[model samples]
Target: MGEFEFLAKLRERLPPDGPQVKLGSGDDAAVTAPAGATATSVDAIVEGVHFRRGEAELRTVGRKALATALSDLAAMGAEAGEAYVVLGAPADLGEEDFLALLDGMLELAAETGTTIAGGDVTRAPALTLAVTVVGHAAAADAFVTRAGAQPGDLLVLTGEIGAAAAGRLLLEHPALAAELPESTARELRRRQLDPMPRLRTGLALAGSGATAMIDLSDGLAADAGHLARAGGVALQIQADSLPLAAGVAEVAAAAGRDPIELAVAGGEDYELLAALPPDRLVPASDASGEAGEAKLTPIGEVVVGEGVEIRLPRGGQLKAAGFDHFAGPERGSQPEARERRGG
Candidate 1:
């Protein structure tokens, strides 16, 4: 049976009066008590697909797995509350390692003020983690979607991009990685292993007249396309204006890769990409007290077109193309793989 079918069977086995189950499992659907402006999101992590087995610590893996889902909540301008986690682990995982994974998840939950209210565990051939987070927004309309950008809007991004991608390349090529400074390598490693959601930035933009916005989980090129399509407008990204994290150029040069390509096509930064009205592009410091540390940089403009186009600093406009899941046999390319990694 498929995973969904299996989950349905498990839900059927639950007793009717199972603890505070205002919403039980099974049937065509189930209902939960109406929450205040409820916001929900789900994410899944697989062993070979998301991370290499034995390459990451149990705690770090667990923390990253949960943080992935929370990133979505933050993008929606939601305040995280509780989460449900489901695990599928191979028989080879030791009992202590399994416990450590749970402990790691709990650590992140405590830090984020979220609770692990419920979940399930099962045996599988590979290790997998899936999470569903439920949060609430004070007002439903306060949430941001990708469909409101307009012509003349200024594109702004929070934090720097490409660090996680650089870190991944380092993990695969230790010799080249050695060329990077110790501090740069450490920071890149942290970004890859544990990403912070742009919760405050997203919310701040939502309140600051952002026309459209999306979380930069996928590569900037790919996610920009999503926003453009949703908004029925064209997004023009300036290649020269991209904000690159410190040491990104050194790391990319060592790997013989293009730093701009890494910034455009690498995924999982978990920063916010927003389009704000031109006149309203006030510095982030003017909006929030902590903005000085995470400066917002304007890198593009929304235009009257149907899709995304990147204007290179040196030459012509290039179509914005990154990763797609159903691109068939043409899916193994570097950009495509990076895009698929986001989902």
Candidate 2:
């Protein structure tokens, strides 16, 4: 389909007005009404770097393109209002593939009650998708920041980590899948290929005195270190307390790697890490929307230092590491197209 056809399809899929949006797509600009505090975030995904052609389909990439931004909104304890995307591709790309991309993104938007407002399309050398999301907070101060953690606060995590990293590894080296159980391989691959944001859990904690919060886009150790530094306090994490998903250790062993390394340093888990005051450490069964049940668990504590430290067996300590764009490629870094293609 052409640009006009694309717009028409979008209009049919997304109405011009929504429950919280006054105006939407097919206009010079879209308009929307806000509910209290508003939060806006932007995220971009590119072919080869964030995704591999043989490993992930266009639909999966498109879903993740928006999910990344939604994860940011979830980190801030905000409810999504609307989203706009700017998609670009080479002239040679087929219409079917492009439509699949839109279908994938729209499915995520619908699941989260977020409306697609408007966006621009153009030609480019490679596939590129950027999503700008607008969200609203429950209250001005209800939104949590990385800087709000206080000493003595408990560090809580939603769900397990390292599954995505393992997934990426399998994608990069598909041969390894032969050694892993089919169920294990599928789970690992799914986490890397399609991930979800922690929206409900975040919203549930907004007014429950959650002090600091961050989404685990990178690895837990690295992102947790960031949160600790932002709060100007040391986050002493208990290594044994980390919530690693089942089969991670086996996957890591089969891949000839350490489970702890991936669990702490593997990126793109999209889990939420929060710092809560002592009294706010309610049972997971009691959290709003069943948000805490079975998924929320305490893994560490904030102390009076300036960085992060992990408590290990026999009083041992380990430094946490995460992905850093400026630090260049490390473990879990995606290969450049030329490198992957053996150029």
- By TM-score, the best candidate is 2
Give Cα-based local distance difference scores for all models: 0.74, 0.78
Q: Model 2, residue 2: what's the lDDT? A: 81
Model 2, 215-271: lDDT tens digits are 987678778888988988998888889888766787688778777776777778888
**Deviation in Å, model 2, residue 175 alpha carbon:** 3.1
Give lDDT for model 1: 0.74
Global fold similarity of model 1 (TM-score)? 0.85
What is the TM-score of each predicted model, taking all chains together? 0.85, 0.92
lDDT of 2: 0.78
The digit string of per-residue lDDT tens for model 1 on 215-237 reads 88777888898999999999988
Candidate with top lDDT is: 2
Clashes of 1: 0
